[model samples]
Target: MIEESQPGPGETPPALAVSGLAKRFDDVQAVDGADFIVRPGEVFGFLGPNGAGKTTTIKLLTGLARPDAGSIAYFGADFTRRLKAAQHLFGVVADGNNLYPELTGRENLEFCAALYGIGRAEARNRVEELLERFGLDYAAGRRFGGYSRGMGRRLCIAAALVHRPRLLFLDEPTTGIDVPNAREIRRMLAGLAADGTTIFLTTHYIEEAERLCDRVAFIVAGRIVRQAAVEKLLDGARDRRIIELQLDTAPEPLLSALSEHFPTNRWEPRAGKRLRLISTAEIELAPPVAFLAERGAAVLEARRLRPSLEEVFVEVTGLAAERLSAEKGGRRG
Candidate 1:
C-alpha cells in the first residue's frame, strides 16, 4: 500500500490518493496493487499499453466500477465507501462522446447543467458560456450527430464542465482526432490547468503526456513500473547518451581499440559508413576523435541523440509505445 503523509492543519490535501488499488475481471487481474497520488492543480498522466489496466483503474477511481480491493481518498476525505458523495467535486469526460445525438450542442450542455440542479436561467447562461469557451458557438445550434469528430469531442468536454468541477478526468481526450483539433484541445487543457483545475489525463500519445503532464506513471501488465516527474526522468537519462558516428569504412582494428579503451560503452556497427556508440556516462568526444584520426579514418559525421519520453516508456515497460498503440487500436476497431 502507498500512503501519503498527513497534511498539516488547514493545508489542502492531494487532489486524489490511492493505496493498494486492485481490480479483477473474473480470473484476470486487470489492476494489481496500484498506488499513486495526484497533487492539487497539477496535470497527472496515467499511461500504459493496451490491457495494462489504465481504463479499469479509471473506472474504479471514478466510481463507475467497484474495486476488488484498495482505498480511494479525494481531498483528504475517504471516498472509497461513498464515491457518489464526492462525485460533485469532479467531472469526467469519457473516451466516447455519450451525448444525445439528436440534441444540439447547446442543448447538451444545458441538459448536463440541469442534471446538476442548476437553475433554468443559469443553465442557459452556462451553456452559452461553454459553447463560446470551447469554440463551439458557431455550431451551438447544430445537432450533435452532425458535428465532426473534433467538434463532438469539444462539446463533450464542455458538457463535463457544466458544473465547474474542480477536478477533471479525461480518458484519451484527443484519440482519433485530427492533428489541428488535438493541438487545440491541448491548448485548452493547458489553459484549464493554469486556471487551477486538477486534471487527470490518460493518453496513449507520449508527446501529449510529455508536453502536458507535470508527472507521469507507467503501467504494464497490471502493475505500475515507475512514476516520476517528467523533467527528472529526462534529465537523469542524459548520462546514457547515444552518439552516432559516420565513418568512411569499418575498421576491425579501430573497433578492437575502442573495446579495449572503453569497455563500458556499447558499440554497434551499422551498414555503410555508420557506427553507433551508447555510453552509460558522459565521456570525452576528444578521445574517440583522436583514436579515429590515429587510425587514419575519415569521419563523415558525428551526432548525439537525446533520449525522449518514448524511449523512457519503452525502457521501463519493455514494450514499444507504437506496438502497444497498434494493439489497442485493433482491439478498439
Candidate 2:
C-alpha cells in the first residue's frame, strides 16, 4: 500500500501537482508550460485536440518521459529523484495494449502482481479477484492475443490495479472500443471514483469528459489554455445563449434589425429560412421576436438552444471538436 503524507496544519496536498512543465521532441515543443493540480478523489480530465500534447503531458506525469523543465510533486513529496519509489503510488493504462499476448488473461494479472513483489498465495487471490471485478472470470483462461479489443483493454486496466494504486492515469481508455464496452468501462471508472480513487483521464471526446470529469483542463498548441470545474465552466457559459429563429421570408431585414436594435448580438443566416442569433449576455427573446413580427416576417419558430460542454470547448479553444477530430484523422491518414 502507498503511504500518505503528513500534511502541515490547514494544508492539504494535492494528489498530483505539476508546475511550468515542458517537454520537447526534436523540432516540436510537445508540452509547454503545462500546470495543474488534482485534488484527492477528484476525477481530473485532460482535454485537447490531436497533437495538442495531451499524450506528452501524460508521459511526463507518469515518468515515461522526463520533462525539460518543471516540478512534479505527489502527496506532498517531490518524486523527481525517486521515480521508481513513486511508481507504486500510481498506475497507468496506456493508449495501446501493454501486456504479454501469449499469456492467459489471468496469467497477465498474476505476472503484474508478481512484479510488485506480491506473495504467491496473495497474487493468486488478487488475480482471481481482478478477473471477476473486470468481468473476465470466464475468459480468464483465454490467451490475451485472442481476446477482443474491449476485453484486452479491460484486462490491461485490471493489471494496472494489481497494486491498488492511489492514483490511476487512464490515457484514452475508451477510444476505439465498442459502445457497450465503453459504457461498461466508464461505469467501472465512476465506481472507482466513488470509492475514492483519484483518476487522471485524457480524451478527445468532449461529451465523455463532460459526464465524468469533476474538473477539466484544455490544452492547445502545447500549452494549457484553461482549467476549471466542469460545473463552473458550464454555468458561466449559461450567460451566452443561442437562439434559432425560422422565418418564412429572407433573413436580410431581420439581420439588419438585429444589428440596429441588438448590435452586440451576432446574427447569421442558415439554410432554409433559419436565422441564428448568438448573444454573450442574457437577453429575453421578446425583443427579437417583436422586431421580426414588425417586419411582416412570419416567425415559424424561435427557441433557445441549451448550452453544451461542446459549445464551451469551442468558445475556449477557438475550434470545434468535430473539426479538430477531422484534422487529426486526416493527418493520420
Candidate 3:
C-alpha cells in the first residue's frame, strides 16, 4: 500500500525527489525524463541491464555528475546549491575500490572520519566498532592492497557509515563476493533499513535486490519501465509459476503425460529424474497439480516459485541475460 502523501501548507519535503531527470553526454541520452519519490526510511532497489543508465542516474543524484535536465531535491533542499552541506546526509559505496590501497583498514576509516570532521577519539572509537561489526577486526591492521575483494567491500561499507548519513547509496555492494559474505551483507543491509536508513541500491544481482528492497525501479535504455513493491512485481511477472517434480525413473511416457496434463507449462529437463516447469502469467499451479493427481500420477514435489527478479529484468528490457553476461565478460577480458 503506497499511499501518496500530499504536502501540507508548511511541511518538510520528501527525503529525496527527482523530477524529469535527464542527462546527456554528446549524442547519448544516458537518462531520460525520470521521476520518482523516495520516502524516508525505505529500501529502494534500482534494477537495469548493462548500459541502461542506472549508474549515470546515481551519479546525478549524488552530484558526481550534472544532469542536462530535471531537478533533484534532497532533504527538502535544492541538490545543486546545497550539495556540500548535504554530504553529511549522504553516504555512498559503489563498485570498485574507493579507498586508499596504501593505508591499513583502520587508517582508511580514520581518514574518512577526518574528512567528516569527527574528533580523533570519536573517530578511533567508531573505527574500532565498525571493524568489529563488519568482521574486519582481523584485517584492521592490514593494508588494503593486501585485502581480498570481499574484505575490501566490507571495509568500504564500514567507511560509508562512519558519518551515520541518513541516506545511503550502494552500487553493486556485494558483487564478486562469495555467497556467505553476500548473505552477511544482505543481513547488514536489512538491519540498517530497520534502523531507519533510506537505502538506494543498484545491482545486477536480482535475488539480492528482491530480498533486500521493499520496492524496485526497473530501468531500460535510460527510461523507467516499472516501479512497484517487490511482491507486486513478482505477482505481476509474466512467468510467475514453476513446478518441480521428482520421479522414480526418467520416463518419456511420464514426461509426455505430464506435458499433456498441462500443455501451457514450459518443461525444462534437469539432472537425474528431476524436471522443472514454468507456466503462463495467468495460470495457477493448483489446478494443474490436481489434474496430475487425479490421473493417478505420483506427485513427488510441487511448489510455486515467485517470479525471479532476473525474469522481470528480461521481460522489461527485451534483452537476454546472456547479452549482459557477455558484455560483463568482455569488460573483464
Candidate 4:
C-alpha cells in the first residue's frame, strides 16, 4: 500500500505556504492555482520559463504585489493580513538592482538597519561582518553606483539580512555575480539553511537547482507541472539508462538481437553512424556487447547516460531547455 508523505519534523504550518494561488494581468492568467509548502531550513527551488509566472508568484509571496486569488501562510500566520508584522519574517533580494545609488554600500546597509529598528552599534557590526563574508569589505566605503554589478548585488543581499529574517527570498541571486562570487553566494545560502533559515528561490540554471534545492517545482505557462524530491527524480531516471553504439555500417543481426532481447526498449539513430538504445535496469549489456563484437561493430564508447534535470524538465513540460537560454538572451538583448 502507498502512503501519503507528511511534513517533516522541522515543518510547522510551513515556513511558507501558498494555496490555490492565482494571479492575472488583464486577460492573461499569469499564475493558476499554485500550491506548495516550504519547510523550515529547506531550499525550495521554483523553475519556469520567462512568462511562466515565477516572478509574479515571488512578488505575491513577498507582498510586492497582491494576489488576485488564494492565500499565503507563513508559520501558521496569514501573510497578506499581517503584512507589516510579516515584514520581519523574511529577507528579499529581487532580480533587479533596486539599490540607492548616492549612498555607499555601508550606508545602504545602515539605512536598512535603521528601517528594521536595529540599534546603530549592532547594525554597524553586522554590516561589517557581512561585508567581510561577501568579500565586499574593500568597496564598502565606495558609493553603490560606482560599484561593480556583483558588488551591488552583494550589498543588496547584506541589506536584506539586516533584520536577521527567518526566511529568505532570493530572485536570481547569482545573476550578476562572477563564478567565484556565485560559488560564495551558494555557500552562504547553504550556511543560512544549515542555521535554520528557509530559502525560496527561482533559478533557470538546472545544475544550480539540483545542487541547492532539496525539492523543486517545475512551472510552465503559469502552472506547476510537477514537483518532487530531487533524489526521487534522479533515482527514477537512474533506473533507466541510455546506451549509444557506433558502427561502421548498419549491423542488421545485432540490431535484430537487441530488438528481440529488449522488446520494450527504444532504438534510434545517432549522428555519424551511431545507433542509440534506451533500456531499463533489468537489461544487462554484456550479451549485447559480445553480439556487437561478433558482428564486426567497433565499440567507440560504451557508457550509461544518466538523465539530467534539464532532461526531466523537457520531459515534463514538453518544451526545450533552450527556452531558458532564449529568455536570458532576450534579457541581454
The TM-score values for the models, in the order shown, are 0.81, 0.81, 0.78, 0.80
For every candidate in turn, the CA RMSD to the true structure comes to: 5.6, 6.0, 6.2, 5.7
Candidate 1 similarity to native, TM-score:
0.81
Candidate number that wins on TM-score, 2 or 3: 2
Q: What tens digits encode model 2's per-residue C-alpha lDDT throughout 1-333?
A: 011212346767899988789999999999988778888899998888888998889888888889899888888898865667789999999987789999999989999999999999999998999899899999999999999988999998999999999999999888777778888899889988998999999988887898899989888879888888889889977877888899999897567767888898877665568887778887678877888888898779888888767677877887755655454322110
Candidate rank order under lDDT:
2, 1, 4, 3
Task: Candidate 4: count the clashes.
Answer: 0
Which 10-residue span in candidate 4 carries the lowest summed lDDT? 1-10
Determine the backbone clash count of candidate 3. 0
At residue 57, what lDDT does model 1 achieve? Answer: 86
Q: Provide the overall lDDT of each model, using Cα atoms, as 2-decimal numbers.
A: 0.83, 0.84, 0.77, 0.78
Better by lDDT, candidate 4 or 2: 2
Residue-level lDDT of model 4, residues 118-159, one tens digit each, is: 999999999998888778889999999998776787788878
Clash count list over all predictions = 0, 0, 0, 0
Single out the weakest 10-residue window by summed lDDT for candidate 3: 324-333
